[model samples]
Target: MATTFQKCKTDEKNKAYPCASTRCKHPWTVRYREPGGRSGRQREKSFPTKTEAVDHGVKMENDKREGTYIDPKRGAVPLKVYAEKWIGRQHMATNTEGTYERAFRLHIYPALGSRLLSAIRTDDIEQLGRDMTTAGLSANSADAYLTPLRSVCKAAVVNGDIGRNPFIGAKLPKLPNKAVDETQLPTGQQIQDMADEFRPEWALSIWLMAGLGLRTGEMLGLRIGDFQEDHVRVSRQITRGKAGQGPVIGPLKHRRVGDWRKIPLPTNLRDAVRAHVAAYGTGPDGALFKTLTGTLVAASDYATHFKKVTKLLGFEWSPHDLRHWFASTALSNGLPLLDVSRWLGHKSINETADTYGHLTPDSTGRAVKVMDVAITQHRAGLVLDTAA
Candidate 1:
């Protein structure tokens, strides 16, 4: 028979079956057979009115018929268990996995780890954001932690543990824009001054970074052979691997084997590299830049040294600031934004525009010039017509 609901009065003598006493504490029951089962199952729930019970039973019946019913018991697994399984099934880079794991341990686990998967509601997820803020996480940091939780919830929806993602409509906190205001990062004169003032040993690397706009790993990954007649090849990088593991040499970020970018070599940067190579020599594997002891340059070491140098000069900058300077210089020099993006190995031109759009030539003035020419031509045509 089809699923059905009945109003029942319950008492201590007959709790499972219905009793007719009006004073009975519990009142409603629904009878439904599990999918692919011959026997029936009955569940008792408290309902204020028979109409509410009937409506709920009808919805359950429809869900079962549509093969979308999720037995509440099936989702009773604790969130901690589900999250572990979900994270295990993810195929991601080791560094990304480490990041996700860190976020889970730092923010997600402590708040909702003990709750059942089905018991969590939208309000609970909202409270998680609030709790992260209360714990003194910045807006960006809190959002980073919440990213893994959102992914986990999405997986749960696919697994039928939840009908919908609770965090779907929730908004993450906004981060304030902290970008520096400059059309082109330090002009030609300023760059020359910085190069002159920087330590002799480090000047070449600074010039290369400002010239090529390479990421830190990419800059450190360069080998003598990568520099050719008129360009530099970018095919490899060194970056931190999984948590606790140190730096690892690997393929360039977001690329596969043999996928490399080639950027034109500027004359000044080429001269600096040639001079630096003559003075210091390459690493064992021909790394262009190496420590005094001839080992691969570590990012941590570079950061420490750069910080001290910039502090001494009273300049507020990081290694990455040089790359931004390169992009800004390229854009402001009338180079095509798309070309600049390719040279910098950006994933797309849109990324290039978003990062350095402010440095692009003024489109409004160009449009006005075009319109002026068109209007001038039209007026000349009218003058000729009158003379004819």
Candidate 2:
């Protein structure tokens, strides 16, 4: 597209004012043509002076040649408004949407909401990180807050609303190691005791979690129809949406809607499930575990019951600790790492290995013993050969 610079004439006087008029706020207008059908439409903007207008028009031409021109007004939208539109466009799960919305409300909006997309700077991002740290947020929590912000900034860059992401290279708190510290995990005995102590009505669910490594969400979302004679299918999960909205049922994490995993049922667990079913009919939603009111069980309610049971048993652990117990027990019992990973519904084998690999029993002593036996056999064969 072609570009030009022109002087703006005073309408009443019908006279073109010279550049550098202290009184004339908008003395010059830069004119350019945009790409359009048949003799593209002309677009223009006013500047403070003719020289400045000409420079801007030439820069626009150069930018057009390089395919990097972004209209200055494109990023005039505030961060909060742009973030809201961006969030709306995403086809995320209900819980994920709530998480992003919560992040925006609690982290991004308070610090950068009113700032225009184009006006945000790297220092502003750094300052925000510092503020979050000063407010006693962990590195992981701060990064969680920054995640949606980074995604939105990248989208803005892609939409040509901003030249680049200000937070791209900004300093953030260093995340700690990702390994699951087994020291915090509950022992198998503790798990068994907790399960044994649970009210008969909730005992089967507790046993399933401790044995199968299923997430709390997956366990609560289970329905009677999802279970077969030999195995149970994991197709959906439940999660709490923003604070007061309560638990929401949705597809399993890292899976498409309607996708599922089938886990082989243990004989004892199947019997327990059968007994539980006989005592308590399916919930209104056909859920295997339900409250007295026949609604699908809420995780918080389960936790309350679990805490009460553990306290009575003289121990304490989150429901998720049951899954940890399963992973450690399975790995110790010679189950293949890959199978354990699938049973846990992990997105990748590496994730499973990173979390539980260290928990696998050490084999250095066994390795030495095996090597010693091999060496002894080799010497015995040499001695027999020589004697023969």
Candidate 3:
């Protein structure tokens, strides 16, 4: 796959009796190409010394045989270019795509975007994370900002754009360990109190998030068609785009198109939906919540509204906190953990447990009491058998 040679300068008669350093600035050159389909792709790199040239040539040949060969020159492609291409091929959700792009533009691009993919070492990636943290971002926030870089580097390695992923086996910043508090959740009455802070059109946001455990985007993306008397179909969300662009409807997090899950519509939430529909008559796209001018509600727009409501009520809870209250209330009331996870649209039961697993101190006492009752019943059955 590669060869090394010395091209010494000839004399005036176009003949060279001996090679010498004085005659040529870079006499040694490594000629390399991939295997089989490497035709017309032959390229060369000049080196100051024969040993350096030959070493690189051998490594290239070995890499080709090992099936991990990439055009050494192609690795020079800027990270931003490769990252854009990599993200484009991924077909990610709109919000996720926007996050990746924003991460690149704000954090990663300025530091490393122009650097060659081949040149970025694990140390550089780790250092960038530290720099972001030192720049006042929390450890978790820094890691979140670096996620796009980590993913892009990983993909580069998989696609052979680079030899290895810098992120793999690298020590990354960790989120601070936190003790879960069950009291973080709000009560149904508390939710209603917050709902009263807004008009019916916007009040439904609080109900859906608190009552149904809907995510902010999912709540904003709700439409009349997605709602039934008995159940609600959760299939899409509102996702932000580039800075100046408006949010668009996209598939639910971690789900593909045409995939949906039904959450049972409770009697109260169902009645609330009907009242709102009767008053507002739905927006142009049958959306349950919208502005007065018949436009789709964006998550950011509603976030601003929620901040105002929190200021007014002094409840100090977010829309997401309402969803958390839904989960906490369900779990505390004996709802199966797996069912709670499903209703919250969590990716896995483990996630639900990690976030909402903390319960009250009396929970274990309740478990023991139930066990006592079971044992008593078993003893009674044994005595009845003996009597028979």
Candidate 4:
């Protein structure tokens, strides 16, 4: 049950002044218990008139009885507070977690962090995306940047902090074609030119990537024992499993522990690995390559040299481009798409075809030939039947 009463007002001097029933003109205060009748916690709110106060009190009691009551305070929590907690609960790679944290700090916090969870409107979210695009990020990049916030809002809905996610059906900016552009891939001579910029050990690493179509992390995680005369075993990669911890030896991308794949070793690649082994011996635990100081060749450390050489060579390319070059070269040389996918250790053959199908050797010519053969056979049969 709820009761209405008028509370005393304060003067400009910050002193309480009492008001009698005859002269009382203060707002009405509604005092009531929470959902469970007398057992529910006592709560209070004030209204300008007796009627509004009575209506709000009745609605509160009924909503609680129906088990649909959401604490007004829960929705008042700041988005930043909730979002930080959300990040802590996610099971993600260290680097990815780091990226999300950086994005939230730089992009989200300044704009909508102070807003209450219930107050964050769909307009605010769509506006944030536009702001990112105006700052020169692609529409796809902006969308990715908003992923953590979008997830946080959805989780809030489930937690009963808000009724619905503001992100649902919002009009975000459009993205362009995402298919791989073969022009970004480096050529054979360009690969060698960049390789020559590194010392022999690291140079061989570049060649292994291009020849075997292996990821940079997979190449860095190689062991001397993994190399054979005819093939190489890919079993692990250097990765950071948890946020804040440095990279460690982890399973390959898109693979579970103990899963492995093997790629055929061409004669030239085999000779290159042998030459590297002969020259520098090997790092601890049979690691095929490492820094001069014998540390695991980390991507951040390796990228410094890669960037310097690419800048000097007057070309913009990344280590992964070497892998793309290998796939393109193999596809152009008549290797089957399925074989290329296997060589690259892709999760599926369709993945390889989707990215590099345009590079398939003489695809248009082969289609034309097939069509011509079908037409000629049909016409020949028709002519023979007419003659008979």
Candidate 5:
């Protein structure tokens, strides 16, 4: 028997194989025997130039043997599908999964969902990042959009769906390394004024953030049961999700075994928390903070309300500024770096010192004084130094 290759027709009646060429693309028809007793007809893409079409066909055949080929008929899976699968494979905690899912839905999918996985190039990713930057997304946020995409590309490579990960050498925009000055610690007067402007609940929220260094999510995630004899346990956080997905409760961010701090709860704050719990506790699962409906309070809810309060009070601080306030206050009050680190739940004193060391003017002055005293003592012990 002779193997025959026949040119396919452009029209449906002639019914030949379709061409894979983007321009002048058509299909070619072939009848071939299977390894079994069955015979079948396969249609391949037809190219205007036979050689070009044959070349692509040959390469595709070779890829089939090398196990590096994906059927065009299957099409390139969209990034969204791969992302969902990848997230499922991740051993992330509940909160982490929630956060990643939110980032994917809100950021990555909107940017790159329509493109085929194989069609994604470094240029595409770079441009996507640029577009995000141009659209007023922060550098950090733009970089965040890349995280899910990178994961998807890697998965494609592992599955042999694509030859190389395009994001491998992609250049992302540089994020600002400087701490945000506008959200930095508030002045004493500013804190007092801001506190005075809020209702008891909102004021306490601000106080915990600035006064206790609790993350906003952590503060909202707290329950009455988490309070101990003297300290509040930081074991979980509240995260918001997109669409109909409700807020998820998960473990503390960057949590470690010894990550929890046991700062003494102020008497007033403790009393307020107890009172609020007594008055509004929705039972065991009842969140410490909630809307009028008794549901988990969204970060947006508190942030928007806090902003209004701050505006009314003429304070220029953000909710996170409370953390800075706590750190700065501790350092300025002569708290040792190690103690401050423990109080702030920092992994190390070095981290604490790096962030608030400049606030320790008194410590610096004391170091100078100790050096001066040592020099004075050395001079006093010198015999006839002036008679020399």
Candidate 6:
């Protein structure tokens, strides 16, 4: 038997909502009241057969359960509305708020601003990746931009607003592997030369960064109280951004409770830090580093000064390069990876090994010496011949 679906209208004038199929042969109509209100009844018209009307009703009921159905007349919602809702629900850490804000302003809104939330597809996400790559954005940067959108879309799916996350199937660009650039590290002699060329105040900070491997944020966050006669306690670090920004005084990255130990201050560095403090004691709230206007210095300002000092010394490197130098130099000087990891506040020794693996030498002479001693002892009958 062949089956046909028909469009129809329902009876009931007071409840005059329109339906596609009707029971009457000539012009059966269905009427239903507006949903959730006492507004005027909406009417649907013209079903030639009773079977057609029943099938339409069954389909509507199924669509409501599956959440695939949308009223044809109601329009789509804008993306910005959903974005605001997502932001409000986000429980971001203090250090991460600025990053989220930047991602929203620079990436998400600009790329997907005009698109309807319902119409966004995986192809749209893939196109975003391609366009970002074409525009010279690094693969990592492009990924960062897309990550927030993925989160937003995931939220939509969880809430039943959408069926699936579009970003799940989108192809992303390949990210470059990050390795330390050895050229950036200054040699021991170069460090001395820079210290000699720059003012004591400027040189001191550079020396700490290069010699002690302190992050710029940690350096700027140093307080008078953090420094003792023997060692410095790295309890807090300065995060870059505007005032009232959270995470101003959080523990060091990957730092465990017992891991926060004191780093002994070298004689020269200790003296220089003392002198700088004597000259510029606690600003308003006892901050160690401050601006000319006597306010806490921003990280960018510290970086500017660092660059100026490095330039004056004729060294073309970033402040972070000094930390790399510290790690590399320590490894080259035969410091064990575990010791270096602890000194640099790394989470694990594996991190040190991975970062400084290139610095390891063959140690063939030491191995040969051990082998010779073992052979002589074995021949002299002083030791057991394990090789035999």
- Candidate 4 Cα outliers beyond 4 Å, as residue runs: 1-76, 93-102, 105-114, 130-144, 154-162, 170-176, 240-244, 345-351, 362-388
**Reference-based TM-score, model 5:** 0.67
What lDDT does the true structure give each of the candidates?
Answer: 0.76, 0.82, 0.81, 0.82, 0.68, 0.67
Instruction: Give the residue spans of candidate 2 off by over 4 A.
Output: 1-65, 196-200, 242-245, 304-316, 360-388
RMSD of each: 4.8, 6.0, 5.4, 6.2, 7.9, 8.6
Better structure of 1 and 2 per TM-score: 1
For residues 1-388, what per-residue lDDT tens digits would candidate 1 score against the true structure? 3433334433445544566666655545555555665654654344665566677677667877888876767678888898899888887655466668878777788899889988888888888888888889888788888888889888888888777688877765676554435653566666666667766766677778888998888888888888887899888876666666665566676676568999999877777788888987888588887777777776667777777776776777778788888888788788988889898887777777777787888889999999989988779778878999
lDDT of 2 by residue, 2-67 (tens): 445445444434356444555565567777764443485567877777778888788777776777
Expressed as tens digits, the lDDT of each residue in 176-263 for candidate 5 is: 7433343455876777677778765556567667666887888888777777767777777777754566766666666732345567
Model 3 misses residue 50 by how many Å? 7.3
Tens-place lDDT digits, model 4, residues 1-388:
6777666543333233465466555677788876666687888888888788989888777777777776667788898998988888887655466657867888999889999988888899999999999999989889888988988888888888786689987889997754568877788899999889886678898889998988888998899899888999999877543444555777777677788998989999898888898999888688888878887777666777888989999989988888898888888889898888887888888788778888887778889999989989779778878999
Better of 1 and 4 by TM-score: 1
Q: What TM-score do all the candidates reach, one by one?
A: 0.75, 0.75, 0.79, 0.71, 0.67, 0.65
lDDT of 2: 0.82
TM-score of 4: 0.71
Q: What is the lDDT of residue 152 in candidate 5?
A: 71
Tens digits of lDDT, candidate 6, 1-388: 1123332332334243355334434444333332323563453433565566556555544555665644422225567677767778886644455656677677777888777777788898888889888998989889987777778888877776765678876778987655566766788788777667655544566688777778887776677887778778876566653345532544566653224656657777778778888876665456677666776666777777667877887778777788888888777788777777777777777777777767766588999999989888768544454544
Q: What RMSD does model 5 have?
A: 7.9
lDDT of 5 at 304: 84
Q: On a 0 to 1 TM-score scale, where does candidate 1 land against the true structure?
A: 0.75
Q: Of the candidates numbered 2 and 5, which has the greater lDDT value?
A: 2
Ranking by TM-score: 3, 1, 2, 4, 5, 6
lDDT of 3 at 269: 86
Give, for candidate 6, the lowest lDDT window spanning 10 residues: 1-10
